[model samples]
Target: EPEVTQTPSHQVTQMGQEVILRCVPISNHLYFYWYRQILGQKVEFLVSFYNNEISEKSEIFDDQFSVERPDGSNFTLKIRSTKLEDSAMYFCASSVTSGEAFFGQGTRLTVV
Candidate 1:
């Protein structure tokens, strides 16, 4: 079965540098989302995109973040300026509808 795949399962970056987290969402799904969990915290939604535009974004999705579908099968999230607080498990998810969301194993971003 097709599954969402995220690269560099763990990354350590400087506080001011940039990082790009890559993902390959399940093909045939129309909705894609990014969520983050800060250690013991709950999974918080960052943004959702469909039809090439953002469908919804939470307050956490500030100017420092961006998402794109670079090709037919790849999706990426770029953080322009990493911060210490950015350390968390970033999950890439996709669903045909709201009821069947699936998540990638997750990329753990660590900023120091």
Candidate 2:
């Protein structure tokens, strides 16, 4: 079966530092997205990418954040500057169509 894979299941960083979270989606999937869940909050949509461009984004994906598919197989999310409020479990997801997306286990990011 195909599944999304994220690296460094957990990460600890200092505030004001930059962090890059990575993911590899199923080979055939066309749409990719980034979602996050603060410790006690609901999962929130960050951004969605397709055809090498940003297809959609939520308020959370502000100027400080960016995403890329550096290689055809890998997708990444970068936070220009980490903040205490940025601590959360970030999930990478993908889907063949725009409907339901399959998510990676999630990468827990902690900023001190």
lDDT of 2: 0.97
Computed on alpha carbons, the lDDT of every model, listed in order, comes to: 0.94, 0.97
Residue range 27-97, candidate 1, lDDT tens digits: 98999999999999999999999998889999999999999998868888999999999999999999998
What is candidate 2's lDDT per residue for 19-104, written digit by digit as tens? 99999999999999999999988999999999999999999999999999999999999999999999999999999987799999
How big is the positional error of residue 106 in model 2, measured in Å on the Cα after superposition? 0.3
Candidate 1 lDDT (Cα, 0 to 1): 0.94
* Top-lDDT structure, candidate number: 2
Q: Give the TM-score comparing model 1 with the true structure, all chains together.
A: 0.97
Which segments of candidate 2 are over 4 A away from where they belong? Answer: none
Error of 2 at 52 (Å): 0.1
lDDT of 1 at 47: 95
